[model samples]
Target: MGCLENLNYEILAKNCSFKETRDIVKRMCKERYEIPPGFKIVGKGVVGIPPIHVGIREEKLVCTYTKPCHGTFVILVDSPEDIEQVRKNGKPVK
Candidate 1:
């Protein structure tokens, strides 16, 4: 999925990248609450937002399934503190 801004929570899913959202949906359809080893997918977000998929490997997310053509997967890895924490411990963002 993409990003969600100000909108009623009920209608947010209508705006996400369909393929990305669809893949995630399909995986969940096969089995509820499935996540990779040593990680967790959160069931909710701040305020009236939907569930979030955390602990995703940023490197792995930029693959052919999501892109389908030659392009870029822009990851804004801001914050030296956060980067350092991940580098040092491999801990997923909370």
Candidate 2:
């Protein structure tokens, strides 16, 4: 398996629709990586704050919005390795 296989990712956002977030990520993967079918969103609504869902596809970890919150936020990570890279790069996850 690739290094990114079965990775986990977290999504942080405010005031956003889950469906909209999922659609946006689907579009991005299709346009940029030519990923077919796209990632699968799993899990139920999270209590407090916005609901967050988790799933995996083609070794890429994906998190999606399930509840609405203020402000818009989005993020993507290939693997735990990539998470570190994102942190090291000083890119805000929120």
* Top model number, lDDT: 2
Computed on alpha carbons, the lDDT of every model, listed in order, comes to 0.27, 0.38
- Candidate 1's residue-wise lDDT over 13-75, tens digit each? 333443454344444332222223333111211121123231223312211112334221222
TM-score each candidate.
Answer: 0.21, 0.30
lDDT of 2 by residue, 1-94 (tens): 1322354444534455555655555554431221112222222222223223333345564444333435434445456543233234322222
Candidate 2 contains a number of clashing pairs equal to 4
Counting clashing residue pairs in each candidate, in order, gives 0, 4
RMSD values for the candidates in order, in angstroms, are 12.9, 12.2
What is the TM-score (0 to 1) of candidate 1? Answer: 0.21
Query: Stretches of candidate 1 above 4 Å error?
Result: 1-75, 91-94
- Location of the lowest summed lDDT over 10 successive residues in candidate 1: 40-49
